[model samples]
Target: MSSYLDGGGGCRKRRRGGERIFKFKSFGENGCPVEFDGSFRNNVKALVEYGNLEMNLCNDGVLCWTFQLEVHRHPPLNVLLFVVEEPVRASSINLHCKHCRYVGWGNHMICNKKYHFLLPSKDTVASCFNCDETNSYESNPEKGKLNLVELKGHIMHGVFHSNGFGHLLCVNGMEMGSDQLAGYQITEFWDRLCTGLQARKVSLCDTSRKRGMELRLLYGVAYGHPWFGRWGYKFGRGCYGVNKPIYQKAIEAIQGIPLCLLNHHLSISNNEVSVIFSRYQALSDHSIVTLGDLLHFMLKLRSRLPEENITSSCNPTTVETNCRWSPKRVEAATRVIVEALKNREFRWVSRQEVRDAARAYIGDTGLLDFVLKSLGNHIVGNYLVRRCLNPVTKVLEYCLEDISTVFPNSEALIMNNSKAKPRNKITKVQLMKDIGYLYKHILNDQKPTMSTGVLSAIPMATRIILDTKFLLKEYTEEQLPIRGNSFKLFCTVTLRNNEGIDEGSKKPMLPYECVSFNENTTFDELRQEVEKCFREVYWRLRSFVVEAVANMSVKGSDLVVGSVEMGQKLVFIGSNDDQIGSEDSSGTGIVDCLCGAKEDDGERLISCDICEVWQHTSHALANADADALLNNIEKWVVIMMNLQRFYLGILHIFTCPVVRNNVKVL
Candidate 1:
């Protein structure tokens, strides 16, 4: 509230309404008296009348006003004004809640009423303050409640620069009790004030302007009122004028305190310590701390130590040395690398690419390299030169060996030819399997013969070689048809990693094997053939449990196919097992289920007692019957146990109509 211009000559004048006006003789850069023009003067007079504002002239001949109006017999509200170059000392101001009328001053204020603010528009130089009342302890009705009431007055001040821009500073409402003003009322006041200032050619700075004015707040004032952010005020401009050095010193003092000590003193959780430390680390020598952030720091220290000792405790004399690649920095760098890799299109990435991606977060190169090397599976080559062969070039070279197309040895020709060639539809796994099949026939000293399916699945160049050698033949010409319908079944066998065998020493297995079968092939015959093939490929299936599952290519999921007569892709997953299954004389391992639906169809299956046929509970039982079975499951289980026909493996049980006319009731 201090005047920018001081010791200016004053000339007294009178208007027609007998209202005295003191004109300041302060000169502008143009040598003209820095006085309000007649139009601005009249505008101020009209605003004062409309708002019922009481006008007053300061000793410096500057105009000011106090808002005091009663529209409907309301009590006269007093407007409190305080002028200070720095923050108002806590000792000088009294803090109180309007509800309890408690007049005690403290570092923290507790109120039962929660206030909500409506932010101002970005273009408006003024701000509107309002609040909605929320009961803090609504669950406990017996507790005393605070009510929302109209605030006494708004606390604001204006400062104008000689560069034709102005800044309007407003104090937070918590201390002055002026936060509950209506939106329209605050808007009207700001509009009139801004208009008068604009008439005097004092343009308020707006963010939309290319070269807007800077609004600087006092370090102490802004730090004391964190709630000003709710009114759209940002506090990143440091402090006003000479107070910046003091603000920087305070920031450094706070930063000097160990995060662990702060967490312990504040009773903050370990999980929250990282967050608080991150925010603390963000504070630099040139920044100010909001009151909300430093509230606990100030209260705890002030309560335990004297004012002079507080600074000493915050800034301890001892300093602890830390490693450059600390655990926290390593973790941060790892997170950045992981996030970058997730966004990347390819699995393989170079060290330089990773370094560039994480440069923003991890400025230190040595720390990033350490973290990269620590990633056991992610790192490809040497610690310094972590690079992978370019996948695009590898794909192009692989295609060149398969296709008949020829191109120059230059990089440009390879790239262009790769695009020009027909897109290869076969996967690398399929191509490898075809080559293995051909090699096996040759090793046996037999003529290498391939069906149309195998020939079509190989690369174009390999297909041309087979055609020229007269090794590929039509499906009908290669062999006569079997008794019934015939189809080829594609099978994949995945062997469990043996304990004693090294991965590199193990033989390379084909991706999948194809076997021809007819409708005459029984389930037992198909199972035997698969087991024989597994033994020939790896070893005997004695040490492994082979579970065959059909991969429904259309559905993109593996399902247990009932028959191998139809063509389908099968996956044989083998796991090492120490104990082989003993033959069950009662046939417990056998699945003689009548239900055609797959187990993964999400329906509950129940087994019958007599035939031991698995049937879907939904299809076999009525809703009420199923509910009754569920309600009395224990009794039914006891009945089944007594009959020696209980199957604990099955979750639900009910007799199928085909086995029995009526379901036996327990």
Candidate 2:
């Protein structure tokens, strides 16, 4: 007989040399031994010493034992009972296999007395007996090979030693009816094993006292299984394993596991899961939930409950409002803006284009502005009101300065191969040509009327004058021209006969002349010079009227010849003696309206009493109901002036519909 210590440090004896085996119904007619095999005997002894196993002596002197058994067919049979005819042994009994030199006593090649004489069948054997084949049981004809679905149902099993080191036994799926395996059975089994291990210390300790000890590290062998990696298990030296000191892999596993399955297994409510997930999200700065600190938090939660759910659906509003700005996302957005500008031909980009580049990461306009403002040193404008002239329109518009300019300024130089060259001084002849081209278009009615569009076109003609540097002229009291300071004005002169008939039968004689003048020339002096050119003409000259075109309309204002802008058009109307004194020489009676209508047309006129400017009544009023308002024009002007709607130009008059219907109007 061999003696060993039981769980309470009491000595126990094991019976030996029993050739006459006593059979019990539980062990079958071919009685099985109650001794453990060499490989697994130490694990059984540890469990017994920790009080995980219960032993009692029966009235008949038979020893009965109760414990949990985790097997391949049914996991965690929590109340397996066995009767021992003698004292339970603590030491392992080793047996040898001649074929493979394997020295395990139970289930390796054959079941021996160590396994209570249980027969070595396909379901119970670990290796083949005669051939020493390790995979013989898996290849057995009676046990069909597992399909992909059945293979996915594998479960995990492990034991944590007192030294804080854990050993994984196996993760294998059992053969079962199709109905028994459904809906993430593998994860379910893993949760159960983890739960059992977490409670192992508590369940083994005496109930009268409480212990706070827990497993620290869990290491497992995956046996070349690829799915082990999918569960956050890493590999080392051709074996897969997991280490949970900080539970980094545990958090990874929780992230991959479905929330619904976790909730089901962990018995966590949806609201509780949401709270935990929200807390994690609030603490994480970036859009993604992969921070190390957050992962540590989730691992701590999982450690507390073992099966605690760590992932759940988050509230979108809460996530948007509470999440801190991420430096990585800001960096990404900045990179996008820079790249967009770098790909462009100009050093400036519109605000809309900048917004579009970073829209994916920074959706809020104000937040995007804040980001742009933070890059103020790199960009050109204040966040809200940066302005740049549009290349196409030449109009000032909101824009962002290209970050490429601030970073190196080399990218802009490389991209803009056709950068604008400095404008040279425009010659007098070139300025004349540009003005003439504009006049030609205006005379042909091909250009739009003088509105904002025509005003925009003025820059095209004036750009030549703006680019030129003219030398100032020194004028004498006699007004003799300074040679270098003089420019030629090209004009077309039309001469009419005394009776207002053309000199030619087909058309009036339009003579072209080039008049030269200096900066000191007055309007009267220039007129006299032009009169000298036609001194010998048969028709007597009338008053010489010089009119300047202003605001796209010919105005009768007195012309100061030397003060004329470079591109301004001038008209000289010379009538015969019969036409003299018939019309005002200054042409003061002329009127121009905002609608481009002039005075003395057939349409009735309505004039603003205050400014005395005339507008055609048809152009000013949509209906005749405004006749009363027109009669009281002074009162209407006062009301419009008080409302700040009175403009000095053409009058746009209208009586409200309420007044037309005879309703009292405010």
Candidate 3:
């Protein structure tokens, strides 16, 4: 047991500055084991600042955080009960207050025999109401001071003892509706006893009877070792073989053993057996000797015993086996297997690779099992069907609520609108089919749940945005490569310009959206062509045609137009009104109604401007032999269209002054 020094201030009610004091009561062995008891202030600064930001896209944003600091004086406890017989109802046992109320499959009662076994100290008697002369000792102590061990003398088997445990009551290794032990210092006392028991059991085993007799005779006289204070070896050579009487005698003589001589066995002369004892002892003059204290001392000596033994006759061995087909070679043969799956490449891994990983992951049988399972499934017919159906089902179900917002009329535009409906109304059969499809197709059995599929996609979406941004920067700098003489570059330039003005196109554009154009023209020719297209497009938007601009983006081979100058030059010329119609507009329609009847002045219809500027672009083909221009013709066309409109509406009007004057005359 640990030495407990008197904590000053006995039950003083003084409160330190800024510290709140609560009633402190200790009923267990060493009183309250927790040394520092203070309430903590809850802080929320982190939550306020960046709580919703995630470490990674796949991670959840932190919502809340809390931490508490406490000073404790006792060691941690490890408790296990070895039941030896059928249980009874009213069996007495010691149990923690919390465990006594546990209701679960493994819940059991802890026997409380602590109070009866260990004699109470003076303070305990003074605190215990049962010991009072007025009580006649007929009844148990007050409920608060009830000792589980003295409750009902229950028969317990293989129960480990510890002091300072808080218990309500124990029966059949189960709580009996009340605590039997309260505030007991069980952790420190129990661990010390266990350590001592282990040391004694292992240290006292005799290989020969001579050694045992020698120890017994030597212990017949009192000697001292730290644990048994003035002990004799009457308990025999091996500590385990000692009887209770010999055990007690040896304990008494242990204190005489010198600390320096405790580690080595005493050498006996031919005339007499020499027994060395250590002056170092468990119980000093200051405190009363307790069983726990003695055991603790014994354990300290046992622990200091050296580990040295000579053994001969065993031969070293090595194992040799062919592992050519082992899963241990999975990584080494990864490319081989991957190509094999897609019928791409096939190669065997060296035997050495298998040996290396196997040595490292000695007992990882599960990895092998998983590999085999995956390999076996590769040949299954349902894999493809499952993959396809699972995702489709999952996505549809996941978006159901969002989809429902479009409803009745909104449902008409869904790919499978006939089945789309609000959740509660969705039938079990439909739900199962959708869920099954999603699990099979979209998630590919990797993430069978709807939530998981959505979660995995979040990181992917973030990654796409980052990738698009990188590609855009590279394209503008004309540092990216073009594969061939295709219209890919031109299409990207067009879409990139389009995307800057279109709010609907905020999502990264897909590869299929770009249009390829001819590459034979010079950069100057392309600039002129673009200007022409712009002029043509300006005049086309004469009415309040509020058209929705959808996704316009640059992708592979189209990065040639990623210049900041090019980005700023692109312009959208459409009505500021809200008369937009859906591209796939069956379910939803837009209605533009000017609620305020007061008409705006016709001055609002000022002539739309079309602007033009000549810019040159240089194309560098990665493969000079192919000489692919990878034209930016479409973007050139759109740009020219807008510019042409601006020029025609302005410069061409100068060419036809009467037509412009008629509008002014009105």
Candidate 4:
């Protein structure tokens, strides 16, 4: 909300408290705007998005105004323009803007092992602090000096010049028109760019190489375009201090007229809240306003917010406005208002809605009570809703979650006074070290806790990538026996070379190598033959799973134990060579089949695939499609679909033990 304030002197009357106030403040100027890249500012969108352009207008002539947030590379600086038509008869009035671009920069941490920082002697210069130290990022270069690489320009060391600011206040008699109409954002262009006078004297500590800056200079001139450079000042008169305000005012107007708020990519805080309040107060003094006006007002006064939190404003000197106001109450009210603003109840209509709701209440006292209660009960837990992520914090959270979920406080939930669940079991601070191990063994990253790359020679170092830094801290040869159902990880290590330089290269030689069970089967124990098909390492080791089936085929079948009718399994007893003739020999070969041996031809046999059993004709007909044949499904089942099933030779049967303890569903 800053404007480039050039000297534009005049008189304007603004209505405040129904009294006319004439403004002739010398701290004023012509509207020489300092244009910044205002393309994608979204500060105003924080409020709420309107469904359509029609939603922004109201019968009270309340129109939405725009203000661009200061952000880098946000495009289309003047994407939207908003102007409230002023009365044709109103006197000509102009308001000046003073743009204030801040100076100074913050030191950044080096990306590599060497400590890096910006040169305080010259803000743009970059340098490293640990170039020659033992831990500095490097490799063997020459015999004498450590390998030092010089980084040039600001970006080499990384830069963080915080968002620069702009200021807007009355420059002329614009109070001539009602503040409501004039408050609508008007985009206008200005001219002129300036540069710094000259470089200042620099004192470098050649020995230490780096020192933090004590006081940061607040230069009004924009970067590269310092207005003082064009002023033609002499070293004799201290011209920089004298002409800073004048040059700053002139440079403020050098930007294209900004129309509306583009997009605000920066986070919002109480500072933005304060700015909004100030603007609302300024405009509302002249006329009634809407929620959109309040939004712009917040952006205007956001700069005035105190730099530090007023934790306990016990000191009066630190207070602003000559300490006339209590900082605590002001801050509290400001916070509460911001909290309410997060809720979208104050949209659509304006002051009229508030008045209507108040009048609709049972009484004025009742409305006041409700307001007080609502304010008191508000939680105000998360003041600023942000979606930013911090990697360090996220890693910490993961560690905490692993500990909490798997290792609870042993007090499992109770049920009917009987123990129902397991207890807390993971040992605290059990580390899996990698520092010394990795320094010497750089090629492989497979750890005892992981079973991921057991077959592959290449080590992906899954444990390192998974943010277990807390557990991978200290180096130790001692092993801690792990006990817990919370996490099931097991591994064992063996090396082919256990002597000389190759001893440390002892990797887990077996794919099924684990803490509890190590699979190292000898060749003799395996049968005379092995499966001819190709298989992966894990599957090859588990080949014993099919050994029983293979043996059954070569030797004899194993015993079959199942739940079945007494006579169902041993249906034929001593009878054999069963294949009964079809009842209708020509209709279909299956229609006349019956069960019995060839010698017991006409003994009323029941037809079937596995067995042809001799039974009475009535029994053979009535027992078809019966449960006595299915035998509890889990062990074995004869799916008899109908009484004619045997006639159709549909003696389909299947068997398997579904209740095995080791069966895994997925």
Q: Which candidate is the best by lDDT?
A: 1
What TM-score does prediction 2 earn? 0.18
| Model 2, span 1-666: residue lDDT tens | 111111111212211243122211222111122322111222233223322222222222222232222222233111122212222121122222221111111111111112110111222211112111233334452221121001232232232322112223233333222222221344344333222222111001000100111111111111111223333333211001111221232222222222222223223322333323323332232322222223344333333432322222111112234546664465555555555545543334555666777676557666566555443222211111123334343432233333332223222211112241111112333333432332233211223342133122222212211111111111111112225756444333343445754233323222323355666666666666555543322122333333322122323333444456532333344543433211112222344454343433323556678777765555322222323322333332233333322321111112212123443459
Winner on lDDT between 3 and 4 is 3
In model 4, where is the ten-residue run with the lowest total lDDT?
395-404
For candidate 3, which ten residues in a row score worst on lDDT? Answer: 467-476
Clashes of 3: 100
> lDDT per residue, candidate 1, 1-666, as tens digits?
111111111211111243222211111111121222222222234433422121222112222332222212233222221111111121122122221111101111121111111121211101111110122233432221111012222334443221112234333233334443333344344434444333222211211100111111111222332222223332222101112223233222222223333333333322333332322222111121222234333323333544332121111011226655555566567667666655553334555666788898778888777665554222111111112223222210000011111111211111112352232122333323332332232111122232222121112111111111101101111121233354556555554465644333433232344455555555445555666654433222345445433332222132223443344556655554543221121222223233332221223456788876645555322222323333333332233233222221111122112222333757
Q: Which residues of candidate 1, in runs, are more than 4 Å off?
A: 1-43, 49-195, 198-244, 251-271, 275-666
What TM-score does model 4 achieve against the real structure? Answer: 0.14
lDDT of 3 by residue, 1-666 (tens): 111112123212221244322111221112122211110000112111311211111112111111111113354211211111111112223223222121110112222221111222223323232233234334532332242123342322112211112221222111212112222232223223223222111111111111112212222221222111122112222111112333333333322222222122112211111110111120121121222233343333333433342111010110125444453354423323223323211112222333233434434454433332233211111110000011111210000012222122332221112243231122333323433332232222232331232123312211111111100000011221334653332211122233445555443221111122345543334333443432222222113222222333433233333332221223222332222221122221221112111111111112213422111121111112111111222233244345434533553234222333555533
Model 4 per-residue lDDT tens digits across residues 335-387: 33433334422221122223334343323443333333222211122221111
Tell me model 2's lDDT, rounded to 2 decimals. Answer: 0.29
Model 1 global lDDT (CA atoms, 0 to 1): 0.29
Q: Scored by CA lDDT, what does every candidate get?
A: 0.29, 0.29, 0.23, 0.20
RMSD of each: 43.2, 50.1, 44.1, 42.2
State the lDDT at 581 in candidate 4.
20
TM-score of each: 0.18, 0.18, 0.14, 0.14
Query: Residue 326 in model 4: shift from native, Å?
Result: 17
